[model samples]
Target: MKKLSVIIVNYNVCHFLEQALTSLAKAAKHVDVEVFVVDNNSVDGSVEMVNEKFPWVKLIANKHNQGFSKANNQAIRESNAEYILLLNPDTVVEEDTLSKCCQFMDEHPDAGGLGVKMLDGKGKFLPESKRGLPSPWVAFYKIFGFAKLFPKSRKFGRYHLGFLSPDEINPIDVLSGAYMMLRSSVLDKIGLLDEDYFMYGEDIDLSYRILKSGHKNYYYPETRIIHYKGESTKRTSINYVFIFYKAMIIFAQKHFSTKNAGIFAVLINTAIYLRAGMALMTGFVQQTWLFFTDAFVMYAGMYVLVNFWERHIKSDSDFYPPEYLHYIVPVYVLVWGLTVFMYGGYKPLAKFYHILAGIVIGTFVIAAFSNFFDAYRFSKGIIVFGGMLSILALLLVRAVVQFIQHGNVKIGDGRKKRVAIIGSYEESKRIDELLKDTHYKLNVLGYITSNKNDVTQKGYLGYLEELEKLVQLYRLDEIIFCSKDVPAHRIIEWMTRVDNRAVDFKIVPDESNFIIGSNSSNKRGDFYSLNIELNILS
Candidate 1:
């Protein structure tokens, strides 16, 4: 038995980290393995939890957030094991997942790294776990709507294939970082992951390097792991888009020819700017009416109302100086615009309260400095009052616009499609729970069970034979067959029986144990059901 060192890098993902460790503990029971958890300055009590619950595992706690590559390298350098598994903190392993992966690698001498099938938390196959290395042309095609135009064509939609058979092991150019099992020798030859990448694309870069060194990367679907993907950074405030693009630039610079690298660099930069432009445009259009209203209110109130009132009604008073008000209002508006721009306040669709708070802080700072320089000549109270009023007016206009647009529809309105699940009570209940927890847009109309053991307390409309009657009665938009208790073929037959009807259909993908390839074709007919046959494998 070859010893395996499992290295999991943690960065404030305590909940997922604990589940991963627990899963690994169960999986490693029959294998010789050492777990190394490199904590990247996680303030979420992950270090303390690991220390308390998994004391036997070696823990390297870092003082700062040393990213994925550096943290994994730290563990890899410290271990003497023949194989290294770079596992994510958001993944759980089956009891035999590691052992099977190790066995496959041991048998395949030319393999540098092996990746297993990764299922999402909902048990759906994640296609990116197995993929081809993205070339510049492929990137362009994917980005420019070519892939969506011809989804089934290999020339266009070759990147994402979900329906591949899960029983076969195949070679691939790139493997996902979620559950990459690397040979220790390959790491020694290619060196550790490029630290230039703080997080994303390091996996692909390393896999490409291994392939360049005459070693193959394998996607072994026989072994599987549950990856709660993106659980760590999904809600983080960090700019991952910027980070990923930066990594791509670093990779291109390191590996590609000078000319090619420069072209890709320009292309990626242009793409980023274009996207930013789109975001700005979207914001502009969304706020155009409101912006105009607020501007008109401010300018008209100051120039027309104030100037007219001060000039005609109180002409003899110094308190109503027309020239002073004219210069002061324009200067104030200019200063406010500059301050907002400098503080990144114009970033359209910025909804965070912190950003608004920053604008307030910027306004106050400007007002304080301007007042101090004037030697109390300008009224500090007036500046503060004016700034507050401006911000309040802007925010109020935005609030009214948002209310008008978003408030038109009620919460839980039928705009989101209503789905009716038909299957055993247990399976339907489980699906309902998942839908409820994830806030999935589907509405469950309850289950239809045939077996006495499948009777559940959650809810039940009828039996499996009553699917047609229920569909007509509930006016369901979609039917999801949970194939846990009943055979999938039977459900398919049932669907065929009602194929001519207007109802849309989908399956739970629990039974049949079939991983549908990306190129699988589905045909529906009066006497036949959803027939899916895999035709291509890449």
Candidate 2:
């Protein structure tokens, strides 16, 4: 009989799945383990790669995605192994991982499920390796930031067992599904993973059931594995946030005492809405600030440059009337600002080319309107000169705004804030190479690897788990993520984890033709593109 059956539910993450299978090959070397990969209709040729390379793996190719719980249950029903491991496809296991789990299970008869210390693509430890039942109090503490502020305190850190050392073996309330190993006996007693949970909270439900069925869930951290977490879903997407919190509500409704469950449901929903509100508020403030700053710069540019051209360049021209400043100048400023706004100029990171184009369009529109009147027709040169000066003024204001806000300027390399890129090795390297000619207020410190064996010796900063440490060590001011490698959901989780830190977070979309603020489709041609979005949390 096989000692263990490892089940991995794979989606569109073909690269990560392939790497995981390679690591699993080493893990099963000394242990009698059968691997099952349940493909969820991935269009990325994941099925073909698995069939070609890892033919020994039991492939359960589903025409449609069966989700996390259902997929694991499908493999569990077919396997004859004494232990079943619900492993994530985006993970790398140590050679001894399977053996250690088997040994731990053999020694602990009362333990129904177990989990190991898991590290992220970066070699830093993931705290979710061991978690407590998210009761109402624990949820409250976590949502309010008390958990992170006082992780070691028993009162505040109940959710993640922050009082316990991650290396120590202990009875934990919850084992993360990423590397959860369950005894067959426990499954017989508690039944399969709850099919109701399509994705999130199923692990917690299973763990709670194990404890209820007279078995303890243990955190055996003697062995460590790397879990490239959040591959199945984009962590930063609004959909992810909604589903995650909604899962908590479902869990609470199922397990908590009636009175407490209702309270927890309310608290969780409130948190969800509060978070959404905060995000919207942040975006609004950022856009409003940029809009006003650009307007002020445009007004100043028209006032100074037009007068200089009239007095110095064309000395015969009468000095421009003061009424132009009050009536005509504001009209130009209003038109320019509105056009720029429509062209996507007031984004988290304003694009220079978009701003320039908007100003040009506004200038032409204003010039055409002035042609209707003979008196205003003569003032066309002023508008032309003002537009030129506005471009320069906008650039200067942007530089000044960046310097005042972040203590960094694009021209002065020494004054610019240091930054690091986090994503797949190739993607990070590509961005680093592309950013060579362009100038910004951030200095590319180097790249951090999001997966194993994907980094140059000098370029390696660390992994995602060690992001905060890397930020502190290098004194980095910003971190850019390649959206293709690190999903939005993972990015959101990372941002939440590093809350209160003074660092900007940005994403580079997968499409090579992506641009920050170009409205027309024609603007996204072969030109190089990059956008450094200001972190809303920051």
Candidate 3:
């Protein structure tokens, strides 16, 4: 029998799944590790990717979107290995991670399952590397924001066990499903992950059951993986809030006493509404802040224009009625705001001409919209003068905002990214050629390597040892590593050593067209490649 069986449940994240499989194939060379890609009906051609690039992997293509737990269980039932590992598709395990996990589990018979110290895409430590079981009080602290208020407080921040050191190997209450390793024997006794959970709480439920079965879960920090997700779920969505809290309630009712379960349910339900309200508020604020800001600025400009026109053009301090400010001017601003929005004025990198066109269309719309209402009608001359003033006001607002944000009043400079590659001459040339056909406007700053023969090649900045300094000197925006030439550990080390947040790191698998990386822990994984049968490239 194999020493370990690795199971990954993939949804529509095809590129991420491919990266994970490539890393796993490398990591499994010394160990008897069998990998299973349980694709949950991904229409993004994820199954085809595994079949084409990684024929050694056992593929389980589901007919529909099976939840994370059931899909993992499907693989678990088929594997005959001593250890079973449930891994996420959007992760890259270091070369030694798999071997280290097997060695640790073999040495610690009391450990039912173990999780590694996880880093985000940018090499920051993920707090979920070790988690405390979410009891009612723990859930309360996390749900109401007390955990964030006192992240290190033992009493309040027990949700993540902030008091425990992430580097130390301590017994932990829960294991993250992203990199959970379990002994096959213990799973046989305690049973598979509860299918009651579609996504969120299965890890906690299994951790609790394992403890109840008298085995321990551990935090192994000797090796780490890039989870890329910081987390996979969109926790800010109301649907996620409801589903996650609902899973918590399920755990409570399944494990707690009837009375305790009732209390836990109440707390979770209350938290659901609170979190949902916050989600709505956050979404509203994020989506409309620019709209509201521009609308207010637009209205203020109209107000100033009306005053100027009344005093100078009409020769009357109060030439227009109260409807001019309350009704007519507001209607005018409203039409302009809608039209400007429709013209893509709110988008980043929208040109000055874009806003000008929007204003023109808006003025025409106001003229037509007012003609049907006699109280708001005016001569074409007056309307044209007001329209001209609106154009100046709107352009000034856009320019000032752009200048403050980008430090340039150029409005929309669509700057090309400064990028570099680390690989052999042939691989670098292949990558450069592929990027030419794509929309990524990048100035490839040449390749970086320690090989002396390629030192004289075009775009050779310097040796790999001088990468950080080279990035600083050249103001490099991104670095792409060809996995065929650079090891995963080296890639991770350089990613950590390079402290420039302005610089992003991407990896192009050997001979693979897609370039994958996540800019930060808070951001989702990114992909750049030709648009194929896959649903989306980014």
Candidate 4:
């Protein structure tokens, strides 16, 4: 029997899998390891790649995607190693990752399972590298954002055990399945990961069982690996929300005492349904806020202006008749609103120019209608005044909303976002031009590159190694990667490194294209779209 058996469940991530296997090869140099690649019906030639590149690996090509727990169990049943590791394919281990884990397990006979300090792609330590059990109270803290608000406090942050430093070794209640190193002895006693869990909860279930069976689950931070998480399911998807929350519910029902189980089930169900409702509502609001904002502002401003004109300027003629208010105002508002919507008014972050163009076009259409119709001819001046007033009204409304939501109106006024570019000279230059062309709300500080060409290095702040310092010196709010120059792995690595720096990271993959008249713009600036981290607590 080998000293360690590394089991990897892979699906469609050939590039990432190759890198992981390459790292595993390096890590296996000092240890007697048997590697198993369980390809879950991947059609990306993953099986062929494994066969050709890593012939030593035991390949289990599933006819269907049997999911995480079941697939890993298949490999576990076949392996006879003293120690078993369930490693995700989207991770790259350091050379000593296996050796160090093996050494730690060898010395600690009581450790049933162990997890190392996991880093994100950009080198930021993942909190799940070590976590407290997701008990009801802990889950509450996580669901309500108490964990984030009071990360260092044990009371509020028990979910990820944010009270503990990533580098500190501790006994944890649950280890992330992304990298769980378990003893064969413990597996023999506790059996395999519960297949009842399709994907998400098996890790927690297994960890809880280990503890119940009287084995300490140690979190050793001596070794580190980069996990490019969310390859299987994006955290933002409805599927993720349902499955992740369901997993928690399943765990609670399976383990909680009978007395507490009923209450736990109620709480978990309420949390899940409430979350789903909130997500639906949020999506609806995001899609319609612009329309509501534009319509309300335009109509309100037009009402005030038209009434002012009626009372003072055109007191005798009744040019802005109350009857016209019924027909004319709604039509006017609708035309303008529809035009704005057509020009991307529904986008989360709308371009000011789009609003202006929509208003102008709508006003012209109204004026043309007035010229043709005798009834509307008298109200042309009022319509023009109202249209002009609407521009100011729209700006004011957006500014107010921005101030209320983000505590600042600079983002609304297009004066915010201190940005830095990461790419070769030409790529960075192209991105800079794109940002400028799109009239994005960004302040490009400079470029960060390792290329020695004087053209690319002309405006270079520093090499990628000096990212932290550069960000500090320039007070960068976002970093946009030139996807042609930076690989996905490097982008993720950069994100992890600066995860806590109060900065947003974006990527403009490949070439650039523009759709000026789209119903809604999907981008924030020149880079990829911005992600909204829904605060479940609020």
**Candidate 3 vs candidate 4, lDDT winner:** 3
| lDDT per residue (tens digit) for residues 1-538 in model 3 | 9999999999888888888898898999978999999989988788888898889999999999889899999999999899999999989888999999999999999999999989877667889989998888898898889999999899999999998998899999999989999999999999999999998899999999999999999999998888878234554568788888899999999999899888889999999999889889988998778777777877787778778877888889878887778877777777777877899888867787777788899888877877798866755655676667767777787778777765667777645678999988889888988887776667897889868778788768888998989998999988989988998888888887898878878889877888888776755677787544232212
lDDT of each: 0.66, 0.77, 0.85, 0.76
Q: For candidate 4, give the lDDT of residue 47.
A: 93
Q: Which number leads on TM-score?
A: 3
What's the TM for model 2?
0.70
Better of 2 and 4 by lDDT: 2
Lowest summed lDDT across 10 adjacent residues in model 4 is found at 515-524
Tens-digit lDDT string for candidate 2 (182-292):
999889988999988899999999999999999999998877765655667755446676888999998999998899999999989988888777767766776587678
List of clashing residue pairs for candidate 1 = 163-515, 163-516, 163-517, 164-516, 164-517
Q: Give model 3's clash tally.
A: 0
Model 1 local distance difference test score? 0.66
Of 2 and 3, which scores higher on lDDT? 3
Give lDDT for model 4.
Answer: 0.76
The clash count of every prediction, one per candidate, is 5, 7, 0, 4
Candidate 1, which segments miss by more than 4 Å at Cα?
Answer: 158-168, 235-238, 277-538
TM-score of candidate 4 on Cα atoms, chains taken together: 0.71
Provide the global lDDT of candidate 3 against the true structure: 0.85
Instruction: Say which prediction, candidate 2 or candidate 4, comes out ahead on TM-score.
Output: 4
Across residues 68-89, which tens digit of lDDT does each residue of candidate 4 receive? 9999999999998999999988
Q: Candidates' TM-scores?
A: 0.57, 0.70, 0.94, 0.71
TM-score of 3: 0.94
